[model samples]
Target: MKELERIIHDDSNGLDYILVGEVYLPLLAVPNETREIGFYGSLHRNYLKDYKSGLYSYLSLSGKLWSYLADVNEQCVERRDYLMDQMMEQEGITEELKSRDQMEWVRRANNVRSRVDEIILNEMVYV
Candidate 1:
């Protein structure tokens, strides 16, 4: 009788298995992504799972889902910030006004954020 090796590879399935104590378990590797996904990324992830299941599966299998989501999050945050700044400037939403009328500033900023969120969802997440 021969003892089984610590690690073995199957030729037919091309999978590697490792002996853990008394059991041989398939060796699975985690995806090589370390990006911290935030709200936008989470939204995109849900959208992918719900609306684009095939694409979500492909991305997950290919180990590119995290990086892709991180990229989208970064792009959305950057675009939102840039647009917010531009809209603020155009709408005269200055710090001086904020200091003078805090309530009005809050209202305008809330409106800007709402618009940005809608645009981002339509262009990135829901698509």
Candidate 2:
């Protein structure tokens, strides 16, 4: 979270990077306006997902944002595959479809994709 804040606030990156990262979704249903929502939940996911989602949602802003999002997505894919591979090796599971753990991974991955897509699509733009 601190890293994200730093990246968003850092003046060295110029307005585009700072603006994209600084934008966030607020919790509309909450009684207190101060409550905020983000691309990722702090209680569960690491900051990478939040960071990636931020970049993804802001793709319309500039080509630079799109490229950054792509890079983040690529890194996420590699990380996901590496985690699955490590799990399979440790469990000695050769068959992806047959392994319950692998299937769980697939299910979770799909759910996350859908969720992030929804989050991005429903993002609020402030003037």
On TM-score, the candidate that comes out on top is 1
Which sections of candidate 2 miss by over 4 Å? Answer: 1-62, 96-127
lDDT tens digits, residues 27-117, model 2?
Answer: 2221222322333222112333455566444443433443443444454445555655665566555555447577765665555555544
Reference-based lDDT, each prediction? 0.88, 0.42
lDDT of 1: 0.88
lDDT for each residue of candidate 1 in 27-55, tens digit (9 for 90 to 100): 86657788877889999999999989999
Clashing pairs in 2: none
RMSD of each: 3.6, 17.2
TM-score of 2: 0.31
Candidate 2 lDDT score relative to the true structure: 0.42
Q: Could you tell me the lDDT of residue 114 within candidate 1?
A: 93
Least accurate stretch of 10 residues (summed lDDT) in model 1? 28-37
Please report how far candidate 2 places residue 37 from its true position, in Å.
22
